[model samples]
Target: MKSKLKMKDEILEYTHKEIENIKESFCKEYEHKIQAVIEEKDKEIHAMQKKFKDLNEENTENKNEIAKLGKMLEDANKKIKKRDMEMYILLDENKKQKEKAAKKMNKVNELLNNLQKEYTDNIP
Candidate 1:
């Protein structure tokens, strides 16, 4: 009876120690998995932040390019306006010269007619 009791006590103690070791191992594995998940999330957050920064830089560059194009367009429009003004001035000057030439031609024709009449009277 004593031997039987001792054997039963020894078996119970071994079972308790095995259970404690299994619990410790499960806790360690759970902590390891949680840590790994946290690290992965941190990496994802960093990647998203970098992408956002890159997009902001691209947006800034686009805005600058648009402003530059707008300025160039304004300058070109000014040049066109100046060229149009010059063309109008030249056309007006040409019109005035034509009017002066027409007046001179009329005066010359009248003088020629008068001279012909005088020559005809003298011959008779």
Candidate 2:
């Protein structure tokens, strides 16, 4: 009876040790899996941060381009105004020239009429 009780105690002790070892190993594996998951999440977060930075840079470049285009548009408008002023000056000068030509034509017509009257009187 004593030997049988000793054998039973030894078996129970061995089983308890094995259970403790399995628990420890499972806990270590679980910790390792959690660490892997955490590392993967960190990598994803880093990638997202890099993408955000790139997008911000692109946005800044676009803003700069828009500003440059705006400046160019303003310059073009100024040039157009200058061209319009030049065109108006040319038109004004042309109008003055036409007026002068009409005055000269009127004087020539008057001189021709006087010449015609003198010739007609002399013939009779």
Candidate 3:
């Protein structure tokens, strides 16, 4: 009876030790899996960060290009205004020349009328 009790005690002790070892191994495997998941998430986060940085850079470049185009547009508008002023000056000069030609035509007509009257008086 004493031998039977001692054998039973030893078996119980061995069973407890095996259960503790299994629990420890399970905890280690769980920690390893959690670490792997965390690393994968970190990689994804870094990739996303890099993509965001590149987009921000591209946006900055686009903004700069837009500013340059705006300056160019402003310069073009100024040139057009200058050309408009030149065209208006030419129109004013044309009007003045036309008036001068009209006055010369009136003087020539008056001289011709006087000449015709004198010739008629002398003939009579």
The prediction achieving the highest lDDT against the true structure is 2
Q: Judge candidate 2 against the unseen true structure and give its global Cα lDDT, from 0 to 1.
A: 0.96
lDDT of each: 0.94, 0.96, 0.96
**Number of the predicted model whose TM-score against the real structure is largest:** 3
In model 2, the worst 10-residue window by lDDT is 115-124
**lDDT tens digits, residues 31-122, model 1?**
89999999999999999999999999999999999999999999999999999999999999999999999899888888888898888879
lDDT string, candidate 2, 66-89, tens digits: 999999999999999999999999
**Candidate 2 wrong stretches, greater than 4 Å:** 1-20
Off by over 4 Å in 1: 1-21, 113-124
Where does the lowest 10-residue lDDT sum fall in candidate 1?
115-124
lDDT of 3 by residue, 2-48 (tens): 99999999899899999999999999999999999999999999999
Q: Model 1 reaches what TM-score against the true structure?
A: 0.68
TM-score of each: 0.68, 0.75, 0.76
RMSD in angstroms, candidate 1? 3.5
lDDT at 17, model 1: 90
